[model samples]
Target: MRIAITRRGYITELDGVNKFIFNLAEGLNQLGCEVHIISHALGGSQVSNIASYAEKFFDFQGKFQIHALPFSYTNDALALPLWFLNGSRLINKLEVDAVIINGIVPLNSRKVKIAVNHGIFTGSFLNTNRITQHIYLQFAKHIYLYGIDLTVCVSSKLKEELGKLLNIKSIVIPLPLKLNLYRTEPLGKRSPLVLHVGGRSSKNAEISIQSMKILNEKYDLDVKLIIVGHKNAYLESLSAKYKYMVPKTLEFYFDASSLVVRDLMANAKALILPSRYEAFSYVVLEALASGLPVVVSSAIPSELVKDGFNGFRLLQYDPNLYAKRIKALLTDDDMWDGMSKNALKTARKYSHIKVAKLYLHAIQDIMRMKLNS
Candidate 1:
């Protein structure tokens, strides 16, 4: 089968969506499918040759073709309409069996078009004014279901919201993880280091820092926190500001390579994710695969992290609660060991190979239905 995947610029970035596309393509390729990446042309090295750039940054060693759109735009808003037009033209000409669009690009295609909803943008914008949120939701709903055969939501939370708010039906398929890339070190060998994967607003980075402050200062625990994500000016400033209070307890790694993140997960004692809203977190899954217990918010799907099993699931984004959990994982060796073992076991179920097969099944089922109709 021939498959085409679409995404906007910055394909080489080590973000969640980009990584998922690469991993899924690799998995499909291993399963003997011809995978083609349909993407827009962005600046920098990725514009010239995305395959080489992905290989260098994401360590993507897969067999696939990279088809770039002619024009490049730094602003996604300015680029999207053209992306839909050109992306549709490219996919229609290629005549692939299935077209997997990362987000709602509204590409005009007759193939089995699948739009993967990472999360509800309006849901994330709840903190904003009501008028703004309503406008965003209306605009999102209009474009989200256009010319798409199926909507793939990464978590049940997202799927439930899609059905409830936009009345769009979607399937629940969690993101894929490359299990082999993460090494599960023994709990005894790991340091008292806590890893937080995202620095975005929904990630609740401010609360993470506050919790780290409570851990290092209030509890006087000898632990360190590492925040990893793409470069954000706000996060850079926040890190600098928190240095005075938390001192050596917090560190930020902006635009770190995939290898560096894997290494950190391997050695960290626990992963803290106090998200305000989450569709699905690849970081939480990756941390579990690394044999690291996680302390996540209730916003995270229950399927991924079971409270007191693989990790603690807090109902609120309270710093005191997060600090309490981090303290236990860092100081209580026995509790940490048990949860760490369970974390590894939990990760086995969501391997990239299994996820790829699920995606393949979805694509095949949709195509079969189309043929019958």
Candidate 2:
């Protein structure tokens, strides 16, 4: 079947959502489906000032075609409307079989439009602006829920929220991870290194840093925390103050092509994610696939990680408890080995081939419903 994927997120950066879109398109194409990915002309906030527009646009590669929609203004109000117009025009011109829109696209295309919900912007208990969160929820309702024929959520938690707001059920389809890209090798017992990966603005990073400090002071563990992503001034300041307690490393944003992340995850003893909220984290899946145990917040969906099995899930924002779990995993070799094995097993369930087939089936089901209606 011919399919079109639409996204407003940065294609230039190697963020979770972008990785999902790229991998989905590639997998679908390999399955003998005609796929086209339509993205916005602009990049993300972090790279907007540093990278050129052309540099941002040229970062993605796929088996199918990619169309970039140009916008006159950078503001959300202006950009959203323009993106809708441009995207609708492109869909009409292509005349594809179906369209999958990431986040929300205010387009009135005749083709079946599937809206993918990554997460709830408002319900997030993270350190985010209340006004901005409210505005985002309102926009999701107005643009996303009202504009799509079907909806898909990356996690059951997100699906529940969408069902409540839209008064319609959303299909739960976990994000796909390329398992072949990350393989397990006998890295042996890892060093005193804990890895945290993702954007710096996420409240999870703050929680992770705090947990590290607690672990350092309480257990006197000489562990090093390596945070890989765009560095924030606030995070940098925190790291500087706690430098004596824990050695920290801040790496700049890199694309998916960068091998540095794989090396970091493969060598780390554990991956700690104390996110206040998350739909699904591809990084955690990647770490697990690489034979690294994960420690996540309870707010993260249980399906993503099983506590005391593949990984440990802590109560929301409990830095001391999170630290204790980390210390135990770091200190106990037998426990760490068992958890690492379980993590690899869990990662297999999210294999790229399996996820690709699920997405294809969902799209076909949506199309069948449209036909019957």
Candidate 3:
């Protein structure tokens, strides 16, 4: 079967969404589907110097073909419309059997469109304000999905949220992660440390920092927090005085080359994600594959975490509670080892090949339905 997937364009950098698309395309390709990735960008060598507006074809790792449209405009609004125009043209030209839209707002396809919803943003889409963006999203419930034949969500929570918008249910298909590259190994001992990734307001990193601070102050705990993609000014000052125990990482797209982050997960005792809300955590899955226990808030969905199984869920959003649980993992041997084994077992369901099979089944069903219709 021939398949086409569309997503937002980026050149040398990959956010979570881009990485998800790559994994999906690779998975589909492995299933004997001729997969095509349609994206929008302006950087690579153009069709010609005068034709900065034409599409360019390139091979991505000899796995899938990338059809990138030349989008030159810097204005956010203008770029999207141009992206929509060129993306439609490419998908239509390819004559694919089925097309998957990576997210609600990425691109449009003329083929049998299966709209994949990551999550509806109560926050900003691009540079737009909250009020206007809300209205746009509300309108998008109808306007943006006019041609969609089906809708899929990455999580049940996201499906429920988007169903409230579209007034129709969608299937749940969790996102894929490369599992082989994230192998687990026997650990002699783990460092008394925690990892907090992403700095977005939704990430609620401040609360994670607060938990770390409480541990450092009152509990006489000697644990460290590895802050990635964000830094608090006060924590920076404190860590400086304390000899750089707590460290922050620059926000960059590591693509499949997240060796440093993976190393941290291997050595660290636990991964911390105290977000108020999240669709699904890629890092939590990655950490679990590395046999790293997690400390998260009660707000995180329990499908990915259990209160006392692979990881503990904070019954309340208390910093002291989080700190206490983290300290237990760091200090105890039996509890940590048990949870680490459970974490690895839980990660099996989310492996790349398993997730790929789910995607293949869905795509095949959609193609069969389209043909019958």
Candidate 4:
């Protein structure tokens, strides 16, 4: 079957949502489906320019085609309607068997329409105010989704949350991990590198910095901390603000590519994420795929990080506790090796092609039901 996956943002950037789109497209392509990517820009930039930059990110030379609509916007809230107007025209012309939308957007097409729910931001408890939370939740539940044949949630928690908030039923489908693109390195060959992917407030990046400080000062471990994310002023200032506190070293990577991140994971001792909220974490899966043990907070879903099995899952954002766990993974070779093995095992279950098959099955079932009805 022919399929087209749509996203409002550029797919070249390996953010969580973009990763899901690329991985799913690759998965469907591997399963003998003709796949196409339909995307628009966030800023006021032409689609051709973005597509040129996007070419470097795709490893699959010409397995699928990319369609960038000539639409750009500054405000995401206003972009929805613009996308509905321009995106519908482009998608309708594509004439694919199915179209899977990465986020909420309006489209009036007769073909099978699948809307993916990555998560609803009710606001982060660590950063957002109550009023902001209310407005975000109201917009997500009432305004984001409409005229879609099926809604696919990335996690069970997300499905439950949306069901309760919007009184809508949705199916759960986890994010896909490109296993071939991310390969494992020997545990003994890795450096003492701890990775933190996102720099958002909800990511609890400050906690990771504090924990690194504790790991250096308290444990006297000579490990390096690498923080990678999109360009953000607050995240960029973190290294300078805590320079003295974290006496060892802190490497900040802004606008890093997926290949760069995968290489970092290949040689890192552990991946630390103290997020306050997550619908599902693709970074955690990438770490697991690279055979790197993760030390994430309890706020991350439990099934992803199996405490003492794949990695340690802390209950809170306490720096000392995180320091202790990081130290344990760095110093103890036996524990590290064991966790690394298990991490790879867990990653196999979320392989890109495997998850894509699941998506295809769901799409087929729903299409048949719609036809019958």
The TM-score leader among the candidates is: 1
- Error of model 1, residue 237, in angstroms: 1.2
Q: Supply the TM-score for candidate 1.
A: 0.91
Between candidates 3 and 4, name the one with more favorable lDDT.
Answer: 4
Single out the weakest 10-residue window by summed lDDT for candidate 2.
Answer: 50-59
> Across residues 1-373, which tens digit of lDDT does each residue of candidate 4 receive?
9898988666655567876876787789779999888776544453445444554453443367777667654556677777778888877888888889886667767788888988776243325677866765565555345577788888888888789878778888888877887878887688888999987767888888888878877888888888988778778688678776454568888887778888999989999999878887888988999999999988667778889999999987798888899899888999999999999998888988889998899889878998899
TM-score of each: 0.91, 0.85, 0.83, 0.89
On a 0 to 1 TM-score scale, where does candidate 4 land against the true structure?
0.89
- Runs in model 3 lying further than 4 Å from the true structure: 9-13, 42-62, 72-76, 105-110, 125-131, 143-145, 230-257
Give per-residue CA lDDT, model 3, range 163-271, as digits (tens): 7766766788777766766656555666667887665666666667778877877788777777665344544443455453334321122122366677778888888
* Positional deviation of residue 252's Cα in model 3 after best superposition, in angstroms: 12
lDDT of 1 by residue, 301-365 (tens): 89889999999999987899999988887778889889989999999988888998998999999
The candidate, 1 or 2, that scores higher on TM-score is 1
Q: How well is each residue in 1-373 modelled by candidate 2, as lDDT tens digits?
A: 8899887755554566777876677678778888887875454553343233222422223466757677633566677777777879999899988888885768868887888878765233234587866676677777655677778898887788777865657788778776776756553645577888765456467667777777767788877777766556856766666566453432223232335677777778888888766777877888898999889987678887889998898876777888889888988888988988998888888866677798788778878887898
Off by over 4 Å in 4: 12-14, 42-46, 49-52, 55-62, 122-146, 244-248
> For model 4, what is the C-alpha lDDT against the true structure?
0.79
Lowest-lDDT window of 10 residues in candidate 1? 119-128
| Candidate 2 segments whose C-alpha is farther than 4 A from its true place | 43-61, 122-139, 142-146, 187-189, 214-217, 243-258
- Candidate order by lDDT, decreasing, is 1, 4, 2, 3
Give the total clashing residue pairs for model 2: 0
Clashing pairs in 3: none
The model with the greatest lDDT is 1
